[model samples]
Target: MSSTRTTETNGAEPTYKRRRTQRSPSPQYKLDDDDTYEPYISVAQRKQAKLAKLTSWGAGSDKDKANKLKEEEEERQDEEREEERRKERARKERTLLMEAQEVHERKAVEDSKKTETEKAEEHDAEILAAIASRRKLASDLELAQGVQYTEPVKTSWRPPRFIRERTSEQHRRLREKYHIIVEGDDIPPPIENFTDMKVPEPLIKFLKSKRITKPTPIQLQGIPTAFAGRDMIGIAFTGSGKTLAFCLPLVMVALEEESKLPFVRGEGPVGVVLCPSRELATQTYENVLQWTASIAKEGKYPQLNTLLCIGGISMNDQSHVMNKGLHIVVATPGRLIDMLEKKRFTFDHCKYLCMDEADRMIDLGFEDDVRNIMSFFKHQRQTLLFSATMPRKIQDFAQLSLVKPILVNVGRAGAANLDVLQVVEYVKQEAKMVYLLECLQKTPPPVIIFSENKNEVDDIQEYLLLKGVEAVAIHGSKTQEERQYAIKSFKSGAKDVMVASSVASKGLDFNDIQHVIIFSMPKEIEDYVHQIGRTGRSGKTGIATTFVNMNTPEQTLLDLKYLLMEAGQKVPPFLTSIEDPRAAQGGSLTGCPVCGGLGHGISNCPKLEDTQRRQMASHRVSDDRGGY
Candidate 1:
């Protein structure tokens, strides 16, 4: 046979018969007619018709081949994805193993470097802090055992059902007019005038003689509550007659006791008043004296003895007064606690307890002492707590002490006086002294300059006196005599300016004070309010100028802005533009309600934090580690 097979030249072959490779796919059916000769048309019409019924021999075979190729491609793709997943898992496993080895090596090195004793010490330090914190917690729990609080409620307190001279609509209008917010149970409606206050005619004559015919917002609400035989808390701005509110009721109750019985020597005080500072105690004592003056030997009423038991004054004098069987005792917490502990006088006949500047008492670290004083009273006495600002720190004491107290909060609690013109100026710390000269010129004489501390008070007083400003300084360091002399001089026009610390800011009434200059702003905004309040007293308008610098705290600035805005004062651009997390609550609340701190919340209160840490530590140790 030739190399190329000879076949028919018509169509199936390329003119001559071509040999096919064995790898070529076999046809579905035999080409029966052409197998022996050459590749013919590949489909003889006769042969194709014979196998036509079998579609697999024709178009069906091509379709089957295409489906097989597609299946193979899909299988290959699945295998590739599976391989990628396996590789990723292997990579992760290797990384984990490498990390574990490194960690083990690091631990080995660390263990080698540290001695057993050193490690034990470190561990012990942490454990001790924990133990100390736990002790404080246990102590608080002990204090909390069966302890009661007035406790904040969402609803406002309703007035007690009593005989009222004024109509209910008139009472509603009066409360709304003065922005008085009342809370607690059995609250009595406020009075419209001083005539509505049912007291001895002698005290009424005294108020009339003093030209005080109308009752202030606090007096209207507070006096009635006290008269209703209920415990009460009075929160109002300074110079808003907070003193008269409690003082009037105090005098009335004392007179009532005096009317029923006569006092015997070495008997007891029927009423007791606690003040934070010696000056406040002295002033309150004077106010009580003025009210009692009508009921004393001078007036037609019976002689009612009121004693001022303050420090720097003779305890012998106080003892003598107590021995005479006083009607009322007004003394600072420190001296009062001492007097009570020494058995100088007993509250056996005491039916009234009035605490003025309650927040200051807590701040001065006299909360425990106040509690101790309360412990001396075996029977329930009518407790009255009055503060310009009611901080949350004092809330515990209020709750623990007062039983079902009526909270007569006038205006916004702890808000600065809107009537006082507040002026904020930027002055560097070093340049404050130089600028103070110009500030003194802003208002007339009878001005008060508040310093941050005693040392600063001395320095400012010296500078002002050297400049011939007729200034006098008062602070805790000064004896009661010196402080009284300074206050008298400032009030009598003997001294034009009174440079004092926060000790004088609480409840000292300076008549006709036109201006107050803050040499350096206090750390707290609440103090700032009280400092400025020194000038605006007894329903008169006043001015306050404060010096602030870049070094001043940002949170304080934020608080100051809100206070100024609340009082309708102009806020400086620098203060308004400032921002802080502490004021993220958008100034709805003036300062932190708990601690009166502008920089933090109740949860983050530094005072509470200390208590929290102490509660956690073993034996209540002093450390930063908080209780568990």
Candidate 2:
């Protein structure tokens, strides 16, 4: 055997000699005696040779490098496989999350649908109950017919004798306030300068189109005083053109200033009018546009960016408009205060201030906001205050807000329009429904019934509808859309009777209302006046019949007196006889010597009482004192 061997050479190849394996090993490194010669010796030598070969191969040929490269390639494949698994798991999680979200959204939509269905069911039940409640009455059937019931033709819109009462002081005040001493016997119209009336031609034309060419005494006199740059307080009964009287001059002033400025782009609104209620504010805005449409067309007025800032509307939408700047902003006190606090609008440039229904602002507890608004105006701006009645509170407000305002009394405060008849029906509170039905039978169609509470209005509306009457109810609780729909239906003759809360009684002109029935006596005499005023509008002859229960004797008496005064009639002596034991009375106290009630004297009875004063005062102390 040889370590190296050789083979025979061929024609094209060469052969090499090999070491002989049969040769014996050196004696220092001998194999076992029985062992033949071996190519590689001990394990140590094999390992050393292996390492050496590896080292040499690494240093020269790249075959060992190829093996390492192949190992790395296999490891990379394993890592790629792990990444694919991770990505699959992630995809599964994402799919699950999306499916879960979809399920949640579907559940939300189903819940909303269920809520709407439930609401519809409730509304349907209410309607059915209302219909069932009125089936017993024939009047209900008449109401269902939507037929107009015409009131008996009255020779005059006059009050019955019992309700026609007056005090000496009230008479004197009325005479002095309305019939002032004349310098001469001719008794010229109160207007000092008729020619000074500066109503714009456009306004005159507009009024004529509305068939209102002749100004009410208030309009004729108040317009000039206001136009003459005098702060004014115009006190008049409802239906006395109070809105137009204030609106004509204010719009003209805006137009006059607008003309002086170049027709080029400029800021809007030189005047800001405030009304206490949303409907009033909206009505005022409409009247303003109707009066100023000609000027608006002539480009003599700012585009009248009229903004209505009222509740029940999106504040965001309001903010968007306010940020754009308003030429005229008609708003309720609360919403206006809200926007003002947010710095959404400024009144720095407001030049003219007209508080239409100035008394309403006070009654509505908006005095603070009104004062707040006053602080924002320029010191020299003109101010005008208009009210259906001039109570002491309003007089005080005038003192605070107006600077030397010229007093224009169209009719005495608390004076009723002669066109409105005041009628009080004495009945028990529980019998109101029956009495109302009876009155509706005889009282002709198209009447308004007022209730103090929204629930009462709802009850009454339901009752009327059941009795076959086409009536609609409006109150604070009704959605804005519902209230508007009711109002429009009444206006369009789609509905005959409207059962409403206090909102309907204020600043709305419902001329077609032939009669108004107060289903119950109002809480305050002022409210009673406004309630009845709805019928006798625009100098149109209308009647108001109030239902008074025995429990409300004091209110009935006071309301009767107030109503008479508003109608431009004298209060009869009986209304003032509070000391008369036979006179109507209430509130478990000594009779009013003036009104025949223990709570107040007839002569001293304010149209509306102080809220706290009407409450039982220190009853415990009085009881301890053994006072009845």
Q: TM-score for every candidate vs. truth?
A: 0.70, 0.61
lDDT of each: 0.74, 0.64
lDDT (10s digit) by residue, model 2, range 1-628:
2354455556555555555556587667555764767575896787577768877766655776788677669878999999999998988878777979999999888777765435444444464343223121112323355432222111111222332354545434543654432121111123322233544565556667778867676765566556666667777888888987777666666556555662222354467788877778877877776665755666544544566778877767645445543566677878877877776666666667788777766542565577666555543567777887666445544654455556777555656667876765567788889888877865667888898888899999999899899999998889977988998888888898999998888878875788888877765666777788898788787767776655676645665654454455655555654343223322223223211222333333443244325333545567779965
Question: Mind giving the per-residue lDDT tens digits that candidate 1 earns over 473-586?
Answer: 998888768888998888889989898888888888988999999888876777898999987777889999999998777766777877888888998988988876533534
TM match of model 2 to true structure:
0.61
Off by over 4 Å in 1: 1-170, 297-299, 318-320, 582-591, 597-600, 603-628
lDDT of 1 at 496: 92
Worst 10 residues of 2 by lDDT: 149-158
Which ranges in model 2 have alpha carbons more than 4 Å from their true place?
1-196, 262-268, 298-303, 315-325, 555-610, 613-628
Q: How far is candidate 2 from the true structure (C-alpha RMSD, Å)?
A: 26.4
